[model samples]
Target chain A: MKHSTNRLFSLGAIVAAALMAGCVPPSAIKPVDNLSQIDNGKVIVVGKIELTPELEPDEQVLGSSYEEYRNLALVITDTELRQPADQLGIGALTRRINAPLGDNFFVSHEAQPFFILRSWLVMNAEIKVVSPNYVHVPGNAPLLGMFGIDVQPDDRAIYIGTIRYHRDTFFGTEKVEVIDNYQQAKNEFASKFGEQVQLRKSLAMPVMNN
Target chain B: MKGWVKKTHCFNGLTLLAVALLAGCAFSGGGRSIDDPTSSLVFGYMDMEEAPTSMDYVKLQQVAPRSEAGYWDMGTDDGIMYNQYVPPGSFKVAHFGGSSFLMGEHRYSFPTYGRNATAVTIEVPGIYFIGAYAYQEVDTGFFEADKFSIEPTENPSEKELLNTLLTMDWVEGTQWESRIKNRLAELQ
Candidate 1:
């Protein structure tokens, strides 16, 4: 009886570990060394991502069981606006940009039109059950959250403007706005990739409902 | 006492196996045939650029409006038919796609908040035929992301679909024949 119980407990532990392993987040794209090296039809998407009411490091230490925003990332897809399923076989063409709470850049290799489906933030709390708490920007208003920017094959660099995401509270109503700051974006691109690289302004705007 | 312990172990193992199998069947996306006329059935047709290799190649997602929970329904080759027993609710085609050796896997999400959002309401336990659609591949740069566009098509007419349903073995003797005919008449 003791041996059988031990075997069953071992099996349960293995299954739990397997399930936890599947919850690993999607890999973040590493910043490229040279924008010119991002050739072969690849385009560099430069933009600033800001989250208002920034989270403080000491906030999580204050309470043992409070949901606090941990990380913010942009969910970009090729043509559609949907979360990519984490499964085997042919899946949706989706990429995640783990942008910091400030100015950031990511590379888009797909020449097709890319859209910022939504910005998702991970909220970590000391809950009894192990689960993921994902809070999307423009939470209940998906239409206002979608922004589209076309990437051309010959384009070397594209500035998608600054994305400002503000939330009233941790799990409150959120709003997203795309601001055009091409001049500042151009200067930033020059500082990172040199002045020779031309940063085309194709600001991402909310997709029209028509 | 040893035999009793062995029997307990066997029973526990069998229970675990049964649970695992049930879980697998619940999420496998396998649809039911025309077995019950009282069952709420959702039928649709898709015209792909290339024929799928298997009957279950293409799949569609039906989502409930309130809870937003959903399931996948596998499609058949007969006019790209998708015959599934869906619960009676206000559901929509969230997305549909399949994989091919050359084109890889693709999914097209139906717009939810625009003029083109799919709105389907299954109010009763009857067969419903969502409109037919044809998949068109959009041109993209080399090694770039693939794109597809869907358009409403009317290749396999209602008459043709009714004839095909009548020929299916599962529909031959079942009340599904009258149910399908009645539903198609209402559609027309």
Candidate 2:
């Protein structure tokens, strides 16, 4: 009876730990240090989020390190472990962390006059990945990019698609514009995401999902 | 038994008297248009077809004769739909007047519903329903530029107004209790 009780306690602890791991806050994926850079008065309508073609493959993203580490295990005794256990499946790790953050930023109640492309459509939009100084993976090179949006006050639109990331070296930075221009990107967004979605558009309560 | 019966009768009488006094005091204020000579009772149903993330309301104003303008939050009466009974005297104007909110503050010229414009007239002791409409037009000029405009609703339906009143709060005297019951009876 005592053995079974001890086993039950162990199981409960494991379950609690697993649940807590998934509860990463929205702020974790993005930097909030310079949030003042974003103007409060101006609205930010998220255009198409496109990832580059080079970072498209899972092997390239996850690296050989992913094969050894299957889960977030604290201890790794085996020599075959190619990457840190927590670093396994970086692509999945990124999506799980950032997708909801992006969704909440554009579609949540506080974000008015801000609209995002439909979820399914956004999934198709290519996202550019960059090497970052922020995320640390053992032995592997930095491979994370961040979006720095500039809103045009006169136009009330995103200025141009620029992805900024830290250079691989210890110093300096690099910025790249998305292949599509601003007009083309906005047009594509309007076509796909329903152009009528706006703050002054018709008001109606959302249907309860339950 | 007789003493108990007498006590219950006395309690019932007091309860009735209290209810009557409370009702009288509640509506004694400027709730009714007749009670307040300075203002008239005005109510309306405002809606947006595509709901915004946070807010949705028409900015109504009474610029001429008396200056008063405010945003009325509309409530939903149906599934994913919104309608409401605006509190009385919201459109308080001596004559007729109009109201509008800033469509774009950045613009050089802002529009108004009153002041040289024909305002929505409010009649004393009578209920007037004004329907407000606001919509966004895509690509009016610039690429992905949305145009926002507000206009009065055409063919304001009394039935629809009653439906909206059903979802509104019972604020002592919205002046639509009997009208609402009658409409519901007709529907039945």
Candidate 3:
């Protein structure tokens, strides 16, 4: 009896170890370096984009838990999808790009706004993306808190490595490399310039039926 | 006593094997892709000039075969997020078919009401981005534009795309898409 119990415990330990190993999150987000002088009001053509998978199959963490390892096993699989990137192909990269930019998210409020919303840049109008490259999303390390307080939603974040661009300079057209700091630049622009009043008024007016 | 112990040991080993098999089966692929035999992914944003603050959620449903559904917390034009796997035949017709499914909304003061678009078509293994939103028209309740505008370019601005995706929960898989496709195929 004692020998059998020992074997059972050993098996449980191996399984727990494997689950823990899978929980390790991906690498930290890195910022790009040595940006060239971009001319004002210049539209940069998107040459290549790095489309990384925002979530892993087995690693999807919906909520947190503080139970014995045995109990935690049942809850761990709830949020995971049946398939990951292997089956989705380039679609995984494309699926995530569908969201609309809210009216106020990028609009500048100031009289002399530092930023502007150009059709091509805001709408993803120009440029050809090469075959997408892949990367894993950052994972949530298990947290042990009282009650259900520990089970917090993942703080929203965007991760990107680099972008290849083409820009027209005084001399001629030149290809440039831009580091995508996960949209940090856009966020900064939003915070600094604020929302526009005229755009808001236009949005609020009722549409006239033809 | 020794024989009983041996029997219990065999049971435990078999139990472990069964669990492993179940896990493997949970991740299996189910259906075929329409283009180049690759699975489909459908995603895009709804461009709203302005939305009522009362509106809190956007609901999406499969309309063709008439199955499947999803909803997301409300978002703005600065960051609109929509991502889903496109089941085969959900939007199969070729010439600029509109709105694979119906898009509606949930508001605080009112029941869910909105319109559907018939012009959108599903482009398998490709990203289909649509700009849409719902509005109330006096006694008419709510409606979405009939014409589904397609973003013509292969790639939108990279920084802009990242900005939108940051707000969404992680999504993966084809089982849902496969099931939808299978049902539609059966109906046809």
Candidate 4:
């Protein structure tokens, strides 16, 4: 009886770990340590994500909380926004931004233009009783919500402005706005990469309204 | 005795979870014979460079006629033919791919933007041909990500497909032959 009980407990733990593994956050891009890292046909893209009425520790429970934002990931694709972006696809790249709010940057190959296909968030309540949930802004319709950023061949640093997500009472995305805050973003990039690295303002604008 | 009962309960719970996960890969309904051809049906041909095996399938998502918004999964025959009894509405090729021993699972989504997007509207569908497409994988690099392109092409014409259907046992006595012929004529 004791042996059987031990086996059952071991099996349960493995299953739980496998389930949790799917929600494990993708690795965040490391901040640039030197100027040469952004060289060699590579460009640094900077942006910020803001979640209004952020998730609070008290709201972490089994049921739905005030806001379930845990990890926000921006999916970048190489001129293939016609179909929905598959983060795992070869042409697609994902940069995970730490939850709630902060400035983030990612390095990309310079020659090819990139588009911010969409943003998806993983909602894992701090308490471990429940599994994680996912929420995608723009909810898979219209397909015109993609933002395009064109990088010039010689451009070293590009700032795509700030993306603000407004959540409703049910935590569904009520609205998404791309606001130009290039001055502050420029300052942040300067402080990190130093004043020598030129920060170019290339705010991402909505491609179409359809 | 209490430990034994707890072990059994735990085993049952794990079994249920495993079953639920595996159920997602179950074959979606495809190639089922339709009694009445007059009912709505959507059919298409996919000419893949490397044909998909029995493990592969395609999916269509109904976008318009909001009342019937849902997905239809259609398994292929020789990775070429796919037919489903979809309602009369606007549908889009959401994605298509399958698992293989060597390649594992791969899915390619049709473009949802620009002119190359894959979509068709069946306003008054007896039967609708969504067009023939050529699917090819783009070689990015050895260690680079996999990329693919799906484009519309005119090959294995509608008449040829109609002739092929006429030979099938399912279409012999039914109205499918005439319906497909009519659809071809409508396209002309």
The best candidate in terms of lDDT: 4
* All candidates in order of lDDT, best leading: 4, 1, 2, 3
With candidate 4 superimposed using the best TM-score fit, by how many Å does residue B188's alpha carbon deviate from the native?
A: 5.0
> Over the stretch B1-188, how does candidate 4's per-residue lDDT look in tens digits?
00000011222444444434432232423343465443565666777665331225566665455322245765355434545366566676656654434443444554321123446677675665667777665655575445566567788776666556556555565666677667678767
Q: What is the TM-score of chain A alone in each candidate?
A: 0.65, 0.31, 0.16, 0.64
What DockQ would candidate 4 receive versus the native complex?
0.02
Q: After superposition, how far is residue B71 of candidate 1 from its true place, in Å?
A: 1.7
Give candidate 2 misplaced runs (Cα > 4 Å): A1-210, B1-41, B51-58, B68-110, B113-119, B132-134, B143-146, B150-156, B171-175, B179-188
Q: Per-residue lDDT for B1-188 in model 3, tens only?
A: 00000011222444444433432121211233223244443434433323222222222333233322212112223324343334444431111101101222112111111112312345445444453333322222144212222223324443345434433333224343443344344545
lDDT of 3 at A183: 46
The collision pairs in model 1 are none
Per-residue lDDT of model 3, residues A24-58, tens digit only? 23211112111222223321111122212211233
Label model 1 with its docking quality class.
Answer: incorrect
Which of candidates 1 and 2 reaches a greater DockQ?
Answer: 1
Q: What is the Cα-based lDDT of residue B126 in candidate 4?
A: 67
Candidate 4, residue B6: the lDDT equals 6
Q: Report the TM-score for the A-chain of model 2.
A: 0.31
Candidate 2 chain A weakest ten by summed lDDT: A117-126
TM-score of each candidate's B chain against the true B chain: 0.61, 0.42, 0.35, 0.64
DockQ scores of all models, one per candidate:
0.02, 0.00, 0.02, 0.02
